[model samples]
Target: MQRPKPAVIDRATALRYMGAAGWQPDAAATALLDKAEALVLDAATPRAALRLLPRSALPTEGQGNDLRRHLEGCSHLLLMAATLGGELDKLLRRLELSDIALATAADAMASVLLEQVCDALEAEQRTYFLQQRGLYLTGRYAPGYGDCPLALNDELCLAIDTVRGCGLAVTEQHLLSPRKSTTAILGAADHPVTGYRAGCATCHLQKKCAYRKRGITCADS
Candidate 1:
């Protein structure tokens, strides 16, 4: 297990999460965002865990047609889960009650922070697998993306003991409990991974995405 330091956050990414990526933040908005960033970071307790399992570990059915396609040609699977922990969730709730505006900004900032944590974990594991096992990883594909059922999150969390390991839990609606937590599956193979969609094409949110409407992408965000 490892945790990424929440020392920085990408403003553009946070803006994207706030659905204001296309507009420039005025001083007030900027200051609010900065405050949100500080609050989110101060409340964050990042933690992550990774487990590499044989491809056979996945059930043959109900894993989603697209997910199976995504894992094609891969011999192994990597289960990853990460969280900013319960303190941030509590902070967001407090802000929600006292200042909804700051709560909104803090929520977006927290999303970016969680994304960074996942990215850091993936990068570290990618390097390790490449150097030690001569493997390459496909981009992460999470539950509820495309045809993948969100229910898969429960199995994934169980597989990695997420609750015990990092205080992460799955809700009745299949959402991560902390609300800032995430779990993903990555395919590992001997050859370089290809056909990974880092764009909006396969995104479940593409239909209602602000970035797509503006003819841009949150890929880099």
Candidate 2:
């Protein structure tokens, strides 16, 4: 079932995503943001899927205990995919400096907007599962986190019918094309939500991360 679309984008949240991507914007960056936001409106489209997947579908071995621990109490998996349409890539096809920066900023904004949309969708699911049916949610665990190989993306995209559902595909390298899209797994828990907080350790930028010094979390984006 579909939920209400999220409200207009939040500048702070978009900045947070840019911060996670390691681009501290100056005035020029902020200016890029306006154009980027317009591009998001014109060029991006969000897609997602929700299902009560059996835990067996998730690889419980390897990938460290962090992911397994997170899903320990859950009975099902929640798979979702959201993407900015291919228009952004078309916008980036030109090999020019100006286009490069615009493509980069717009890509960052797409990440934030996609997450914002999914967060809203996740919240709606949590409300229904918790208040109406008594369940909780684990934070989303995308492939490439910890020891979970990116190759698993193939399995996930296939399971969720991402190509048909959202025009998403996983390359042989396990990368999702259109570059600004993501697929993730969340667990359906039986107790109150706990033990998951966005932190430097779990972030994609944890390697030589500046945010770690400032006590920031990548997932905040």
Candidate 2 ranges with C-alpha deviation above 4 Å: 1-7, 19-31, 93-97, 195-205, 208-210, 213-221
Task: TM-score each candidate.
Answer: 0.90, 0.79
| lDDT, residue 81, candidate 1 | 91
Q: Candidate 1 vs. truth: CA RMSD?
A: 2.2
Q: How accurate is candidate 1 locally (lDDT)?
A: 0.85
C-alpha positional error of residue 178 in candidate 1 after TM-score superposition, expressed in Å: 1.1
The true-versus-predicted C-alpha distance at residue 207 of model 2, in Å, is 2.9
Across 28-85, the per-residue lDDT of candidate 1 in tens digits comes to 9989989999999999999887788988886625676778788888999998999998
Weakest lDDT window of 10 consecutive positions for candidate 2: 1-10
Clashing pairs in 2: none
After TM-score superposition, the amount by which residue 36's alpha carbon in candidate 1 deviates from its true location, in angstroms, is: 0.5
lDDT, candidate 2, equals 0.69
Worst 10 residues of 1 by lDDT: 194-203
Candidate closest to the true structure, highest lDDT: 1
Predicted candidate 2 versus true structure: per-residue lDDT over 145-209, tens digit per residue: 75456787888888888887777888989999777778888887677655344345554557876
